[model samples]
Target: MWEMAPPKGSRLFQTLGRRPVLRAGYAVVIGVLVLSVVEAYRIQVSLSGQHEEIYRRYVDEEEHINTLRRNLWQAGNFVRDFFIRSTPEQAQTLRSQLQTLQAEDADVLQHLAQMSPPSPVPPGVVKSLREFWAVLDPVPITMLHASNEEQYDFIQREIVPRRGELYAAMLDLSDADKQRLRDYDRQFAESNGRAAERLLAMLGLGVLLSLVVAAFSLRHAETLEQQADRHYAEVEEAKRELQQLSGRLLEIEEEGRRRLSRELHDEIGQTLALLQIQISNALAALQGQPSGPREQLERARSLAERTVQTIRNISVLLRPALLDDLGLVPALQFQLEDFQRRSGIACEFVEESVADYLPDPVKTCIYRVVQEALHNCEKHSGSSNVRVTVRQRPGSLEAEVADNGCGFQLNAKGMPDQSRGLGLLGIRERVALAGGSLEIDSSPGRGTRIALRLPLEAQPQPAPRVAAEVPA
Candidate 1:
C-alpha cells in the first residue's frame, strides 16, 4: 500500500502539497478511513467474544449432562442383571459392577460445580442419582434369595422408574442446548445486520481507492502475462521441433535397415548360393574317386546352407521385407512365428481383412509396435501364451498384442523400467510419425497388453505419408 503512493519528490505529490484544496481533501479522506477501520474492529471483537462465551458454556453443560445419563443407565443395568441371574454365583459380578458405577456417577456430578455458569441439568438430577444408587447398593444380596416372579416385581417397581427419570433429565439438557444455539443464531443475525450497514458505507470509500489501485495492478499484470505467453510459445515450439527431429531420425534408421536387408538378400545371399553350388558340383565330380575329398565337399555345402539361413534371419530382424513387399498382416504373422520358434512361448495371431490400400508408414508403425511388444514379453514377461489381434475401424486401424505373463510395474513416469522405456520410446516415435497412438497396460502378475491405433485415409493411399510428430 505504501509502495502505491507517489514518492516525495514526484510532480503529483509536489503539486498536491502546493494546492490547499487538494491537500485538505486528501487528509480528510485518509482520516475518515482510519476511523472506520478502528470502529469495525471493535464491533467484530465484541461479537466474537459473545459467540465464544455462549459456545463454551453450552458445550461444557452438554458434556457434564451426557456423562451423568450414561453412568446412571449403566448402574441400573448392573442392578437389573443382579435380579436376572437364578444362581447366587452370577450375583457377585453384578455387586462389583454397581459399586464401580456409583464411583463414576459421583465423579460425573462433581464437574457441574466446575462449570462457569452452572450446568443446564437441574441439581435435583444429581440428588436423584445418589438416592437411586443408595437404594440399589444392597439389592444384589436380596436378589440371590428372590424367586424369578419377585425379581420381575422389583425391576418393574424400582429399576425402570429411576432410569426413566435420569433419561428425562438428559432430554431437558438437550432441549437447553438447542435453545442456546437458537439464541446465538438470533443474536448473530442482529449483530451482522448492523455490521453490514457500517461496512457498506466504509466499503464505498474503499472501492474508490481500490479502483485506482486496480488500474496500476492490471497494467502490471498484463505486462507480465505478455512475457509469459511469449516464453510459453517459445518452449512449445522447441518441443515440437525436437519431436519432428526425432521422427526424422527414426525414418532415417528404418531406411538404413531396408537398404541393409536388401543388400544381404541380393549381394551376400546370391554369393553364398553360388558357393554352395560349386561345393555340390565338386562333391559329385569326385564321387567315384577318394571318399575323403567328397565328404569334405559335402560338409562345406552343408555349412554354406546354414550360414545362408542365419543371414536371412538377421535381415528379417533388421527390417522385414514383407512389410514393404506385402502388407502389415503377413509381416506380423512371420514375426510371431519367428518369436515362437526362438522362445518356446505360444503365439496366436488374429486378423480382420484390413484395407491393402494403407500407407507404408502406417503399416511399418503397426508392425514395429507389435514386434517390440512381443520382444518385451519374451525378454521380461514369463508368459506361456501371447495373442496378437489387428482389426480395422471406420477411420482407423487398431492392433493389440497381449500376453498372460508375470507383467511389470510402471514407474513414476508411467513407463516400464528404464530398459523397457528405451524400447517403447522408439515405437512411440515411429507411431507419432505415422499419426498413430500407443497404449501399454501392465502391472505385477496380471500380464501386459500393448494397443496401437492408426488413422487411415478415406481412399487408398499409394504413396506413404509422414504425420505431424508429437512427444510420448
Candidate 2:
C-alpha cells in the first residue's frame, strides 16, 4: 500500500525534512547583503561630497561671472561719459578700465573651465563673446589715437551695444549652469535618500533575522539539555537495576555452591571415609587368608584411595579452598603447580615483588585470565612451555602469561570460540573496572602473550582497626 507523506507543517515533517545547510547559507547571504549595503552607503557619501564640491564651484563661478559683467557695464558707462565731455586722458583711462574688464572676464572663464563645467553654453553666448572681443580689441588703439568725440562715438555706438549683448549672454550661460547644477543636486539628493532607506531596511531585516536565529538556537540548546537530563535519569535507573540483579544472581550462585559443598563434605565425604575403613578391615581380616585374598584386599585399598582422590578433585573443581584460606599468591602457586604436575608442561612462575596491595577481585581476575590462556595453550596449541610473570612497580602491578604455543588466528570477531572469547573480554572489562589495561599479542606459529597492568591504588574502603593486646 502506498502511504501518504506527512504535511509540511507537521512535527514529523520537520524531523523527516532535509537537513538545512542553513548556517553557510545564512553567512553568505548576510555577508553579501552587508557588503552591498556598505557599498551603497559609501557611494552615497562619495556622491554627496562630490555634489557639495560641485555646488561650491558653481557658486564661485557664478559670482565671478557676475562681477565681470558689472565691471564691463561700468567700463561702458565710463567710456560714454568720457567721450561726451572729458579729455583724451579721461577717455584713455576709460579704455584702460575696459582692458581690465576684459582681463577679468577671461579670468572668470578660466575659473569656470577648471570647475565642473555645466552643460554646454548656448550658441548665442559664444557668438556674442567673439563679436564683443573683436570690437574691443581695436578700441584701445583707437582710444589712444582718435579725438575724444570720435572715441566716445565709437564706444557708445559699437562697444556699448556689443558689451550689453555679451553681458546678457554671460547671464544666460550662468543661469543655465545654475539650472544644470540644481538638477544634479536634486538627483544626487534623491539617490542618496533612496540608498540610505534601502540600507536601513536591510539592516533592520538582518537584525531581525539574527534575533530569530539566536532564539531558535537557544531553544534548541534548551531542548538538548532537557534530553540530556532525561537520558541521565534513565541511565541511572538502569544502573541501579543492573546492580540489584547482579547482587541477587551472585547471592543465588553462592548459596548453591554452599549447598553443594555441604552435600559433598557431609554425605559423599563420609561415605568415602566409611568405604576406606571397610576396605582396611577387609585387608586386616584377609591377613591370615591366602596370598591371593591379601592381593585382592590391596587392590580394594588402592581403589578406595583412587576414589577418595577423585572426590577431592571434584571438590577442588567446584571451588578451590586455598583461594579463600591462603589468599591470591598461594592459590595461584597451587594452581600453577597442579597444572605442571597434571599436564607435564614446562612452566615458570616469576614474582618480582610480593605486595599484599591488590584487591581480591583484581587478583581473581588476573588469575582467571592466566587460567584461560593456559587452557587455550593446552587444548588448542599443545604448548609445552608456559611462563607466568608478576611484577609490582611503584604505581602499578603487571602480569604476563606467555606460552611457546602454535597461536591461532585472531580476528575482529574475536577468538575462535565465542564462550572462550568471553574470557579475554572479561579480563579486559575487569582491568578497566580496576582502572587498568590489558594487551594480548599472538600470531599463528608464534606464541600468545597476555599482559595486564593494574593501578596499585587500592579501592577506597574503611581501614581495619588493629587490636591492642593488654600486658598479661
* Stretch of 10 with least lDDT, candidate 2: 463-472
Kindly list the per-residue Cα lDDT of model 1 for residues 1-472, writing each as its tens digit.
3657655434543565434534454565676678688878987898888888878877777776777788777877776666666456667787788778877767766776666665555778777877788878878677789888888888888878988987897888789787988888798889888887887778777667555445545644675699899999999999889888887887888899999999998899889999999998888788689788888888899999999998898899888888888777778878988888989898887776576556777887888888888888888889999988887777899999899999888877557777657888777777777878888888999998888899987865434332221111
List where candidate 2 sits over 4 angstroms from the true fold: 1-160, 229-262, 279-308, 352-363, 380-382, 390-398, 406-420, 432-446, 453-472
TM-score for predicted model 1 compared with the true structure: 0.54
Query: With candidate 1 superimposed using the best TM-score fit, by how many Å does residue 287's alpha carbon deviate from the native?
Result: 1.8
| Most TM-score-accurate candidate | 2
Candidate 2 colliding pairs? none
Q: Which digits, one per residue and each the tens of the lDDT, describe model 2 over residues 188-291?
A: 88877887777777777777767755655565567679999999999999987776676466446645655676577668877988988998998887777889
TM-score of each: 0.54, 0.56
Residue pairs with backbone atoms closer than 3 Å in model 1 (clashes): none
